[model samples]
Target: MAGGLTRYRHLSRSSSHRQALLRNLVTSLVKHEAIHTTWPKAKEAQRLAEKLITLAKRNNETARRKAQGILYTPNLLMSKLFGELRERYAERPGGYTRVLRTEPKDTYSQAPSALLEFVDSPKDVRFVMTAAAVARDLAEGREHTEITQKNVGKVTRYRAGGKGAFEDMVEKVRALDL
Candidate 1:
């Protein structure tokens, strides 16, 4: 018998186990900033990577442990997650990782992949601050400083000759228009 054998340790796992495994793997990848694995593994890793990044948007213990629970290796990942990744992904709203195929000329290369490189561009906040300012201004009773444009659609009458309040008003307005 094979002593201490762990054949197919990463693969051949149950669906739930596989999902958890991939989630942990990708979570660690995001925490550490980079990771390498088989092409198919990388695909699964991307899924987890995006999820972890989304979680990173909210830096909290619950989110951290949620990510940790899904991961197989938590120490290395935890360090990178709380230290580098937490700050690096602060301003990014979502969409954390990108997968790129590595090998372009070989058969194995047919399934190659890589993740989107991290960049430190915190100034690029994905929020429309002006919109919020406008809302605040409106709430404060400030008049709209700019002309508002609107697309007025064609009006159709459902009960034109009926004795409804709207129909009565329409008749009055039509009579006035004449």
Candidate 2:
């Protein structure tokens, strides 16, 4: 089985159960714009979330119905999904979700945890972190490093007025704890 092609993670669940679990995770992702879970679960859910956003972008009745099937409590989230989220990603092609790995969330299970979020949404931590890094570099009179510049580019690439928004965040971060 080593180095073989695998279509998707089974997550040690039966097919129906796996579908339901991913559906619930995707629903929560839509409602909160972010979630923390085991890295495997996050990656699986990221795939579902990305496809769902693509459906929203399509903006058709059939797509709406398909989206409804995937999203629990579709009535509450559909408008936001088809409206706000659709507009948010209107210009971009793909890769709407970002998953960042972290240390184990709890000591017992010791499972690797990750944060999954839509890239340009209000809950984007990378954007905030980039601003903090920039502000810290400025405070220390250091230049922005290559990694920081790369992060800056990624966080700002598809966001509306992203450069201005990041500049504003840098100022806010600079003003704090300085």
Candidate 3:
């Protein structure tokens, strides 16, 4: 009889039910940066979080309200999601989320699930190293303490001896005039 009720009711009628739903989604998203969940729930979370991230990126009053309305999250969580998430994904375009299939778990409900992950593009390490090197050169007026072959972590000396015949051949090569 509820004509416009387009909500996906997961069969619970209490506020606790709804809160638990949101908490589980957020926790899983944070813990693994992804989760294997039902299609409907996964889609809903992806849409909601992406909208929140977009709003956070704008960083204004209207956007703030939009984010607050999207997820029933607290002020602290909302702050982290908005501030830190905005900075983390600043240079990226859309399609920032990914959902993938994984092994099935034997749960009460027989529905299969998929893992959803945030697809952060790889940063250029070479460019980062070059920037760091430039900064060190500027501050110190020289290369920052050139690491000799010894001070760097564990060093493995490469020797040309293995078995008995290999050692004999190496001695013969060492004694060669040519």
Candidate 4:
């Protein structure tokens, strides 16, 4: 069995506990649009999160019930998942979520940690920072630095129009600055 295909990590929990843990993680993700957790949990939850977003896109009764089964607060979060998140990712094909490596949440344990976030939400902090960078250059009458342009490109690629999205984010940042 050494070379046999291994499907998924056990995460050192019973099946029921694992299901509940993942459900809670996905639920929190839907509510807050992001979460920080150990790396393995993030990867496991990412798979479920992707499937749930696909279900949200379907926007049917069956899909709703299936999503409900996976969420802890289905009644409260269903709309966000099926409405805003649904439309956000509509133009795009897949990859509704992103996981980033981060400093360990528990220094004592030294477990690998990551941030799991829904892409293209209303207030994406990463996009905001990238927008701020571009806005600052524009204000100073300077050309877009290579790093700023790269950041903008990364922020806007998944968006329908990269320019529009980046511009919109810059506008939002400016508005906040006022």
Q: State every prediction's TM-score relative to the real structure.
A: 0.47, 0.96, 0.50, 0.82
Best by lDDT, which number? 2
Instruction: Give the per-residue lDDT of model 4 (tens digit) for 1-178.
Output: 7888878878999999999999999999999999999999999999999999999999999999999999998889998999988988887799888898999999899999998998877556678878898777777789988887887777788776767877887888777767
lDDT of 3 at 122: 24
* Per-residue lDDT of model 1, residues 54-123, tens digit only: 6666778888888677666777667666666766666556655545455533465464544333332221
Q: Residue 141 error for model 1, in Å?
A: 56
For each candidate, how many residue pairs have backbone atoms clashing (under 3 Å)?
5, 0, 0, 0
Model 2 ranges with Cα > 4 A deviation: 1-4
Off by over 4 Å in 3: 1-32, 121-178
**TM-score-better candidate, 2 vs 3:** 2
Q: Local distance difference test, per candidate? A: 0.52, 0.96, 0.53, 0.88
Q: Deviation in angstroms for 41 in model 4?
A: 0.6
Off by over 4 Å in 1: 1-13, 104-178
Judge candidate 3 at residue 73 and give its lDDT: 48
TM-score, prediction 1: 0.47
Q: Cα miss at 175, model 3 (Å)?
A: 38
By summed lDDT, the worst window of 10 consecutive residues in model 3 runs over 151-160
